[model samples]
Target: MEKNAIVDLVRSKAEGYFERGEFFCSESVVHTINELLGWPYSEDVVRMASGFPIGMGKSGCLCGAVSGGSMALGMAYGRKHGEPMNEKMFPIAKELHDYIKSLYGSTCCRVLVRNYEFASPERKAHCVKITGEVAAWIASKLLDDPEISQKINPNFK
Candidate 1:
């Protein structure tokens, strides 16, 4: 699929997952990205991202979407065993952080969810939008970067 199409698909899927209450903010982002990228569904990835929701177990640290997006990026570009860290991944991660920060003014979930009650309709709606937007943003970045896309999926064209 084309990049824009893939972005749309990912966004739609993320939104669906959120609306269905199938996953939390972070889980939705990571799971949707992996699904869209044709990666096998990973229980481990979902487990790892579970704590990221509600801002690092509701401690109000980094936004769950941001953390999940970072993990997705790492899955795509992180170094393998015995391989040195890939410096290129840093800029991409930074860009993701900057984009989220630009949108919400902070990467903190507490700041992002300020005044919203947990599991309330208002909070769910807000988080649903964040999950979709973050997933789409990561999809766009991955599709636009040929090197990263090819690295992640050799058949990605």
Candidate 2:
């Protein structure tokens, strides 16, 4: 599929996952990206990301969407054991962080959802949109950057 098409698909799937409350923000983004990439879904990934929701369990650290995007980036670009860490990985993560910061002016989940009732329908809807946007951004980067895409999945196009 084309890059835009894949991004659209990922965005749609992420939105669906969020709307259905099947996963929290971080898990939703990571799982949807993996699924769209045809990668094996791992419960480990979901479990690992669960604590990041509501801004690190509502303590309000980094946005879960941003954290989830970082995890997705790691799955795509991180170095394996005995291998030097991939130099490209940090920049990609930084790019994602920058994008989110530019969009929301802050990466704190509390800041992003300020004044919204916790877990209210409005809050959930806002989070769903963020989840979709994060997934779409990652998918777009994977599809557009040949080196990164090939590193993640040699057959991806």
Best by TM-score: 2
- Candidate maximizing lDDT: 1
Candidate 2: TM-score?
A: 0.89
lDDT of 1 at 63: 89
- Alpha-carbon runs more than 4 Å astray in model 1: 40-43, 151-157
* Candidate 1 total steric clashes: 0
Model 2 Cα shift for residue 154 (angstroms): 12
Q: Give every collision pair in model 1.
A: none
Q: CA lDDT, every prediction?
A: 0.81, 0.81
TM-score on alpha carbons, each prediction: 0.88, 0.89
> Which lDDT value does model 1 have at 138?
90
